[model samples]
Target: MARIVVIGSGMGAMASAARLAVAGHRVAVYERAATYGGALGRFERDGFVFDTGPGLLHLPAVYRDLFVKTGKEPLERCVALTPVDPASRHLFDDGTDVSLPNASRAQVVSALDAALGVGAGERWGDFLNRARDAWDRTRRPLLEEPLRPDWQVLGRDPYPSVRRRRVLRRDQWAATVGEIGAWELADPRLAALLESYALAYGLDPRSAPAAAAVLPYMEQTFGSWYVRGGMRELARALYERCLARKVEFAFGAEVVAVTEKDGRAAGVELSDGTVVEADSVVFGADPRALAGMTSGRQAWAPGDVEPGPVPPGRFTVFLALRGGRPDGTVHRTVVHSPDAGAEASAAFRGEHSGRPTITVLRPDDPVTRPDDAHEAVTLTATVAAHGPVDWTDEALVARYADGMAAAALPAVPDLRERLLWREVRTPADTAAATGAAGGAVPPPALAGAEGRHLHTANTTRLPGLLLAGGWAHPGGGLAHAGMSGALVAGLVVEGDGFRGSQ
Candidate 1:
């Protein structure tokens, strides 16, 4: 049995530690922060609570598989998950409103048709049909399996674009999500709706590949879920699972350097110069930082997926309201921007824009409120990271937060009247919390656009060092992180021959 040292306590690293422990490898985790979860966090005030990270879970099977492999207790027994019915409510700028049901394609299609027009649902349904085709084509190589060295084929677009003729342009297939919306969907409202999916993941639809359809396809097909107590509870469950597997943890122990004696990774050197040796090392952080520690040894090769442009981050406003959550309310609502194109461009370009798109989450679970009389509302938007914007400017933050909150007033009619207090979390907070350089949130790896959407492979050029996290293979998102951990553990236990989870 080899001794494995997992760097960072992000969900991916923790998941790997648990699996490695179950495999009989002595696993130890070192987290720089006092807490285990990376982006998953919580804020509480006056008995009201809010999740600071992802509001919902997509593809829960990832965690379920982790629990089944690591312990006898199933994931359902560990964390109480509630399906978000009417998956989401879309508040378009044109006063068009819609409530899409959870995991029910028929219901969602019907709702879209009823609200938008008779043919709107059919167009959306057809788009999803094509999206599903893309999902099936790339799901394995892009997700379930470990990223391959010669992954050039994955760069070919899996989304079969419908050919359309544009004015003063030759007939062509829609290459990007923006084109798909414009040329195919043909309605500005529908275009905004399509772009919202990409924006939610910090992606720009205009540049994001048509294969990006997989994002919405995965969510709508599998479902959106919420933990009863907040996403933090899910993190707590995984941390506990790791502990149960006898994995040791060291908090406030920052790994300054990765020590190397031979050609392979030897161990990790802590901030205080304490070196802990291990046979294998799992790094759950930016590959650049890992390189800095290993004498500038890079993780990716020439053809491998290298780090692309710096990513955009999330801006969130948490409201502790005086009134209770309304009855029969959709758990998630997206208040669409007045100009989706402008918003997408600004976010991707790392520029500030007024009236950015916002996602409002209001979970009716009593656990989030002080009592039945009070409620908690979280409003979030995709925006430029802390560096581009003046995050330290108090007035700027308040202005942005106010605009986002006001956008949700229609969804929560009594938002202003039911007011208590609101706290804002900028990318600055994300940078401080997750240690991302600019508080940027990496979007999930997508197939197409010349492999530009892919992330660094889990297997590094270094023999014993591996990568796992939102920044690694399969890329960012709760489920992808879990998959990263599984892949890492498989590579560690089964050696270089390991393919992936199954």
Candidate 2:
């Protein structure tokens, strides 16, 4: 059995450690922080709790597969996963409101038709069917496997974009998310709904490839899930699974540099001046830190996918309200901005948009509140990743959070009066917690725009070193991060010929 050293204790790292251990390798995970989970953080006060990371889980089969591969107990036995009904409530600026049922195409169609117009449902249904075609085309290459050497082939757009006739008698093709929305959806509300997914995932709809439609298709088709306590529970379950698989963890052990012997990875040098030897190194931290550790050693040769620019982080406000959660309240509510395109433009430009696209989450879980008489609510918005705006500036963060809460008024009509206390977090906190450059959250890989949307492969030019995390192959989002681990393990255990899971 080879001795493997895994960096960071985030879900992706832990998932790799568990799988490698089960494969009979001796694995040790060294984390810079005192705890694991990375972005899957939590906030609490007076028995009120809020998930600081992703509020819901889409494509949960990633974790389910992880649990099954690593341990005797299944994922269901480790954590309570419940389907979130009325998957999401969209509150458009035009006073158009609709709640889509979880993974029920007919129900989603009916709801949209009733709220937007008679033809709206059919339009959206047709769009989703097209989105499904994209998903089927890219799912295996993008999610179920490691980034291939001939990844440029993925540069081809797989969305089967609709073609239209232009005034000049030329064929107009939809390439970006915005073009797809404008040309196909043909409804401002439908366009906003589609663009919201792009913004939430740190992509501007104007530039994000039409393949991005796969995002909504994945969510509406697979359905959204919630853990009993919070998303933190999913992390805890994965960590515990790692321990059960005999993967050792060294918390607060920051790796300073990667040691090399005869131009191959020999071990890792810790911040405390300790050198730990290993046969292979699995880095689950940010690519920035990896570069620092590699010294002059290049991780990628020419033509390899370059790590894209750091993405914008999220701005969150956790509210402890006195009023109980009202009945018939949907778990997730998205309040669209008056001009979503403008908001997205401002965000990408690192400027503040007067109107913000707000996502309000109020899970119907008891542990989040002190009692049934109280409620815990979370409001979040996409903002410039910490750099352009000083997220460390307290006054600035509070001011932005104030706007987010105000924007959320549509979701919580009595937000001001019901609020008892509030907590705000910026990308600065994310930077402190996970050491990501600019506190940026990585975006998932998309199959278009000349492969500008793909992430660096797991296998680096530096032998014996691989990547598995948000910044790695398959890219970000809770589910994709887990897939990175699976890919890393498959590469290590099965050698270079490993394609992916069957």
Q: Can you write out model 1's per-residue Cα lDDT over 73-186, one digit (the tens) per residue? A: 999999999899989999987889999999999998899899999999899999999999999998889998889888888899999999876787887878898998988888
**Which 10-residue window of candidate 2 scores lowest in summed lDDT?**
288-297
Question: TM-score of model 2 relative to the true fold?
Answer: 0.99
Q: What is the per-residue lDDT of model 2 for residues 277-348, given as tens digits with 9 covering 90 to 100?
A: 999999997765677789855587788998887788888899999989999999999999998878888788
Report lDDT (CA) for all predictions.
0.90, 0.91
Candidate 1 Cα RMSD (Å)? 1.1
Q: What's the lDDT of the predicted structure labeled candidate 2?
A: 0.91
RMSDs, each prediction? 1.1, 0.9
* Clash-forming residue pairs, model 2: none
TM-score of each: 0.98, 0.99
Off by over 4 Å in 1: 166-169
